[model samples]
Target: MAAFTDSDGTCLFNLNDGKRELVNGAEAAQALVDKALAGRDHTAITRICLSNKSYDEGAAGAIAEALSKMTSVTEADISDVIAGRPEDMALRVLAAICGGLAGRSLSLIDVSDNAMGEKGVNACRAALEGQRETLSALRMCNDGLSASAMEAVRDLLVAGDVPTRLTQLHFFNNMSGDGGAKALAQILPHCPQLRDLRFSGTRAGRPGSVAVANALAACPAATSGRFVSLDLADNTFGTEGAAALATVLRKQANLTLLSLRDGSLEDEGMVAVANALRGAAPALRSLDLSANDCTGACAKAVARAVASCTKLEYLGLEENDGFGSAGAVKLAGVLGGLKQLQRLQLGQCSIGTRGAVALAKSLEGLDCLTSLELNGNAISEEGMYGFTEALGAAGKLSALGEMDDNNAEASEEEEEEESEEESGDEAEAEEETEEAAADASVDELTAALGGVKM
Candidate 1:
């Protein structure tokens, strides 16, 4: 042990359990052979952070090589290494982790913020295809993985016919556009056990969004819904694409949480989506559809649909083109009927004193809202003051966590929801006096969830 430590080699300290434990494992440990290496604990010894300051290439190799000879470590955290700059050698170690089937028990592997190019992805693919028993979740977002790399991995997953065991995949802020989206579409049907999927900033426009949701909805995989939680925010899903997912959501009754923030959904698209949500899903809990082009007329249609989605918990409708006082008033009308809404967001939606007054009146009867956001719309100082006063009276924002949809109405009903607060009723008188409303684009609406920002 002393010789290896002195030689700057990786040392595995074994206890009564006969398992090797690395020392001072804080830095490169997770990256070295994260999936390959796991720990075994006993009362006689506890694993400590491996000292990474003096680490060398041999150290990484040693870790990977050692993985083949070890077994039985339940608590494996490899995110620290994935947080570092990519090194070919380190990725090799990563390859070895899966090569040795070490990820069998790995619950999480953080390979984010690294330049794990196509080669690295292939290596990880090899590991994932190994079908390690204990591997349950993976986060490969923000790793500078290009569209080609995603496509490459997707092809491998299909061609290899690997079984679906992984439940979580995070790919936030990655430029995995159309190619990546297509690749993922092919795999979504096979992965029957998926739980959390994040495709933020993947540039997955209309075709990809529509294709993926259609695949999921049409396949038996969706019916099983062993899968849950789908976050496709910032993917620029236009109105048409969003409506496609809306159809899927109708069949997926088990999904609990969904986020499609910052996707450019339009009013007509929202109308289609809202109409679908009224009776399709048997078990959807929360949804977000913020930042869309849903103006007053569109918001009214959506409000009408949400009035009947009894299981919805949260809703976000911010930063759209027509979500002004008129929109708020109509939304307020709908809020008057929702009995289960827990959260609501309406930020930067061209709200003014009249809108604020409209919202305040409709929300007065709200019993479940706990959080609220009115960040950047035309909600003047007076409007904000009134809005705040109403919230103080209501005592909640329901359960809203995020609000981002280019045309909040265009998202696939992932994170936004409906509620009948006092604001809904306050707008009734105004709504009765309203004039003709403009038509919204259905094509543009559904694609909003594809991350179409103005």
Candidate 2:
């Protein structure tokens, strides 16, 4: 089933398979054209996807010819046609063909995952200008766009006589730094309908991030609480940028997903973001703040923010090694309230024995949790046992999907050494007492978990 007509009139043509059947672009284009022609109602094809295929200039022109005949294709996903190869000319031909469609008013254009550089942007300039009025979603991720290319995009938007109806814009993994970010920021106000914005892995630093955040704040959609999702992960948004984004977040009452992973937002910045998320984004469901260098110091604030988002389904706080036992305990206190949470990733946060026990206790309340990743948290065998017991007692062990890779088991020699130390000194006796207390707490937690009404 390489090609099929969706129920919503979307003609999806996928040629990405283990075996590359069509040797050249012309063959692929011919096959696509044949598929389209064979459809029950070719004229009703409102969307065409030629993604993950390779094409040359001539084949692109042939595909364009096919598209021109379709007449009803308002959305075209010509992304990844060259498959990471440099096919600037083919892209230009296809983009120009889309722009030249006499009767078509394209609303969505995705050219992502192609090695289209400045030349490709120049080629698509006409198409973007042609579809400016009706273009609602533009995705150009991983296209190797530079700052200069981004400037060209800004110019295209600026030249539009009226505001573009761009509701979603994804420019991920581009080499456009602060200059490009600022360029887009300067023209973002012209895109009043923009809502979903993804600029992750764009090499954007503090200045770029702050500029974008400020621009989003001033956008009509943001002011009216119409923004849906914002993904700025894998960028360098230090304290200043995080603070600026915090300000924008405060106004996003309707925003759903917010991802800022590996953004260099340390404890201070995360605390600021956590504070902003307290009551601002009530509709938020997916939040990713992993690898932000956050410590236990910010866990309380993060917990508060997480508690407020009652509808949250996914929470990723992985790779922050500073969130030790204390942080995990604080976070555990709030996990019970998130009844809608489906996936919770807390891997590599240094949440050791006691923290693991606390988290095990919270599992009884997470009726919807399907995946819980706590790998590399240094949880001991006792903690792991407690977790297994808790889950089994709650009758959710079968429903739980994934819980693996925790370094919990201790070697027999290590256990023997601990036993020897426990019999040696007064200090060892005190340590033994603390261990007993921890064991007692785990038992108490298990008992409490057994009583919870599932």
Candidate 3:
């Protein structure tokens, strides 16, 4: 770890020892905090990281007493604390105490990787509301937030005396469903400064996805090109959701990264999204559409769209088994235009001998190309030989992800396993979606959307 102090009074008090130190009891936690803060000015601390620890109420109270004195602290990372009732209660006590601090205002608060549920949200409400004037980012990933808990968050955002100055909100891998999505949509317009929004793996389907897209389409930040990164991966967007999202994407000129991986955007949905990218999102640096069931036609559309994105550094089109050698050749045709492309992920897209050869030829023009992932693409010995020779001649390729198992002889078994895995994944995803939907009722979503157009 680097020294905490800087010239500008921005200091970090990091207590995260890469999960090596176990500060379990109150005495241990107090001793650790005292030692870490020794010889340091409490009022000058700007950040505190206490991730991956164990604490009871007494330990949390001691930590809170220290935090209360650090009035300048703006960022707090209390993620991955030990999971249990005592730890949860400790977290609540810590948050409540911090919330009561008279002059403290946080800019970023991350409580990710904790199974705190609704009680955790309630405990943090005061702290969140207290910083409505300065809080910028809130990350609560994998926190077991349900639809009602999400609604509680929305209420907190609006209940403050002034609208929150939030710029980033990450709520990934929760069971929020459509109700939670609708709740978020209701609050999007209030967060005019929001730029980075990540709501991936929330089991949101078409209705939820469409609601969010419609909200973004009307959001002032999104319309004014202030939005930059949007990640909605691991959800079931399907065609309708993709179409809705496409409309939003067309308007995001300042967007840099767009991730819609594993969203079930089949050929039709992918084509819609690709068309939206055409002559749009010129500032995009990374675009991920992996496992989207794209084929040669989708690949052609993406190639045409990305040909104009000369600044693109990463393009991930992996796991789309329908994207065969033909698609690879189509993409290769436009590789010459993407001079800035460094990492290209084409793993398991069925790019065989002919496509590998074409890509090898195209590699000659990419001076910046470093990493190329072609794993399980069925490239035979001859194709690998030519590709390796091309890589050696280019001298820019350093990290090549390919194995002997990718050869033709083992490709059949690999493809079969891949197909079976894909089927199983889809079935599991469907069940999860259904379970989430059951948890959140239709009336709840409708009420959350009250008068909001979607």
Candidate 4:
């Protein structure tokens, strides 16, 4: 059963324990609120979770009033509630709730996965307008927010009493279009302290993407080491959008992380990203371009960039069908230069025995690499054996995933035929066969290093 609890694991409200009635109406919500208010110990309850509940406008106002009384509450979660009240009443309830939070210590608010119509957006804006000084994170995912709502949020950030105070903002699965993106981009200059901006599955097309990139590009160098983290995953930002983002990235030299996973980025987009990374953005420590359309040529460009950025520590290139033996070889050539790299994910990239051999050879110099994922590849026992031997020599890897057994067996059979046709000495062939017999699966390679799952 799920329950809301404090930091010490004490349950404040056991929703499914059957000891207390479920909060489905104004009466039940008022009971909880009254109990907390009577005790005058609202600090004991830091999280307000009324998810999957049913209530009315009266309950919402009561809940908001109860929240206003709490002094130490930091997070509020009112998601997925069926408020059987008029739209205007709901708006008033939301407004009251926001008004209550005006001078509180609240920092994070989540009103996601609800049918919060247009008025809900205004309520959110009003709640945030006064709490801008304290609120650093806001999540309104899938709240049926429109471009007008986006514009309102932009104004809240740029024209509010405490602008540039927000650090993280999430707007996933919304209905914002080009106008919304443009509005958000216009406020980027005002929010100089922004750290994380996420917009997954928001359909921010090329025009919208370029607007955001342009705004970010215009920012001065971050006083801190990293400028900000940008996540645009699951958005259909096509090649044009990718190019625009690449241009901005080249200009923004202090960006620490960039994630464009599962986007519409193809080989051309990757080439642009690679160019942006080469001899620039030395502070960039992580880059996630997984599930893109990157191929061997794209991998070659990444290799050049990786060789130039010596401080890069994480690179995720998983689920790309284009990274083959050629890409692996190119990647292997640059692995030695990335001495600080700790995690490299290249799973399901179609790397075969030849590519594995090149990668294993390069592992000889990567002493800092702790986790490597190579699953779903056509790696043979021989190829895996080479990798295990390299890991044993370096003694740094802690996790390695398994390879395709069927593909490994087929490669082994072919190797036997080639061995029989070889014109090498009998003793040498016997020695090689003995070594092959003692070969270990890639999964067993991490037994000596800690047993870590990648």
Candidate 5:
């Protein structure tokens, strides 16, 4: 039930005495469009998400129509849908409509996880180029389109009437290969206002990666645009590619967040990065190296490097191919050493009870951690218990997840260990026992002296 509610526990869409009934995507979209046109005194529903829902025919078109009609709509998010091939045609229509609308203000439109083929993507590019002022954030992630489609997207970006507020553009997990990325990187010099770019799971190879890195390296600080975010997850950027990119990062001081998660960053690549950002990029705050085949040594090096960059706050190492129990322990040990660490992501790292215990110990020493996302791991009941026990011992915590019986048992063990504070008394009792033995021996000697011994 991903529904929004008001202060009175009433659903936002369930207003107006139940006059607006929307059980499906089409219905909801139609209601929103109709309501906006009629001035029905309702909130703007242009920003919508159609996840885990059924849809009727031409649902995408209906959504696009509602979005196009709303002049005040700033975003439209409808991910994980299987709109038909005809959906692209509808999207084009919406794009045309968005271009023609005088008061159109739609800035974002997310249609990710929809296997809209190459054709659909072409339509998307056409529409976006046509309505550049109104559309900025476009998410076509997790779709199936060849490299050519991505190139088309790049070409469309080059088209005139481009908007400047286009900050985020996510096309990750799509099969847009190197050719597409090349096309995109070519436009980097032109897009002076682009801030965030996500290309994870795309075939952004050495050539494409080099193009992007070069573009970033050459981007001047005085330029109106800065690549604040760069996500290259699940790409095939080996050491050569990473080395080239690392060179760019070394010089690109304006980058605030850099994510190489799922990229083919190996030990060599890690070393390259370690050399690159040792002192450069002082303003960097977020770095994600997840799913990279980097071992504990690499992670330790990374942590050490980050420790020097005092402004860094969020570091993600989840789902790495080489981070094991040893790696987790090393990282946990260094956790408190970092003074500005606020958010840490270690999801799916195969952490066990020992790793959990180490992390708990680290948490006990820290006072700044705000949120920790530990999903999809082997953290059994014991791990959860250790975390809570540490929280209780530390006397304060931002937030912690649920704990099972095993966690409770671990906590009890910790409490028991804490209660044994009178070790001096036990030592004194042992000394007294030895003294009594000596006294008994002396009494026997006295008895023998009195001629009363057996």
Candidate 6:
């Protein structure tokens, strides 16, 4: 009964409505294919996920053939399904889908964790050539893609016959280094619709990161005010790379989400980014400076950045041990005015009891704040108790509204009336019956529905 479904109710591998509880072997695969083929709305099969399914080559080939016949499938995830075999078998399984899905209007394709090495990528390149006009997203994370395979991917990105529609690309945990990054940089200006790009943990060093930053800066979409999100975490991009991206941030008005976690963006680089936010980046909402080496000196810059961003919502500063009590107090000073701020993560920042109390006092002013992560900090029982008391007092103030002490007796009488209603009197109660039980259940459901605010 496990499956994946979209908001539109289109699903893949959903056996919930099927007659059988469980299915197995090539026969079950064929049955699944038959059901798909017999369905009137083949286009409803927008996602074909065979992840973690135990099936043989015959079953895989049948499913691939069935998928090829579908009129339109936007997203397909075939990760970890071709297990217990050589990489070539996995490549063949992918080839079948690529052949069928060629020239189809498939937007997103994920083949991560399949161990499909260079040959598999080469085959996918051929298959993807037909989808040059339609494919907008491709995820090949942890698939053993090397620097050589990236050359083929680069060619596909810059194919001259048709304008590339790629908007999102992920190559996380790949073996590609500066060479692969340079290849990708050449096509960044070509993809005007590119919104989300991730190269985390891909061994893209300083050179690679700088190249990406340059390409992003030169990209027409970025310069023309199209919103874009870029994640370059764990790449060891040093101060020079961070400075280059800071320049990009100053120019790219639509650049919203930027994640440079686990990189070498220390105090200097952090200050550079914060300065960019303070000067430019008005539309910026989410900023993740986590796992960096930022110290307390960068706190004022970050606070200024938050103050500048009137619509800032999510700020992630996790694993930056340099931000101690002083930094927390500095940040708390400005958070009172950020009515739009909601999610804040400051885990492992060395914030002590005093800092926690400072933050808790600020939290009272932020009515929009909902999520706060403070794990791995130095907050003790007293600090936590202070936060609890402050938050509880704020909750009561919000709940009581305009009610004053003068209405205390009226409130008590109302509570008594509710208690009486909850514990109905035996003298006036009717005998319990099947109809009464059903009516009570209906009443309970109605009351529950009425209690819902939204």
Best by TM-score: 3
Error of 5 at 443 (Å): 74
lDDT of 6 by residue, 1-454 (tens): 1245657554553322424232334577778666644554666676766665534556666676676666667777666555566666667666765666666667777777766666877766545666667788888788766777777777766776445787888878887788777877887778777777877787877788778777877776667656467787887667777787776677657767878888788999888878877737667778788988887778777777766665678888978998866677667766665677778888888766556556666667667777777767765554556655765765422321121211112232333343443233111112222223454478689989999999
Q: Where does candidate 2 clash, by residue pair?
A: none
Ranking by lDDT: 3, 2, 6, 4, 5, 1
Which lDDT tens digits does candidate 4 get at residues 1-454? 1234567533242122224333445677678666644454665656666565645666767776666766666767655554554677667656766665666666777777665745686776645666656777777788767778788777666664345666777788888777777877777676656677877777677778667766666643233324567777776666777776676667557667778887767888888877887766767788888888777768767776666666778888888877866677667766766778888888888776656656666666777787888887766767767666765666634556555532565375654454432323223323433432343233246565565655
Distance from true position, residue 296, model 1, in Å? Answer: 1.7
Q: Can you give the lDDT of residue 142 in candidate 1?
A: 65
Error of 1 at 237 (Å): 2.3
Alpha-carbon shift of residue 211 in model 3 (angstroms): 1.8
TM-score of each: 0.69, 0.82, 0.82, 0.69, 0.62, 0.75
Per-model CA lDDT versus the true structure: 0.57, 0.74, 0.75, 0.66, 0.58, 0.67
Query: Model 2 off-target regions past 4 Å?
Result: 1-5, 8-28, 39-44, 84-103, 160-162, 394-454
Native-structure RMSD, model 6: 16.8
On the 0 to 100 scale, the lDDT of residue 264 in model 1 is: 75
What's model 1's lDDT at 129?
54
Alpha-carbon deviation at 390 in model 3, angstroms: 4.4
lDDT, candidate 5, 119-160, per-residue tens: 656544433555455566777787765677776666656665
What value does the lDDT take at residue 173 in candidate 6?
82
Cand. 2 Cα-lDDT: 0.74
Residue 63, model 1: lDDT of 53
Alpha carbon deviation, residue 332, candidate 6 (Å): 0.9
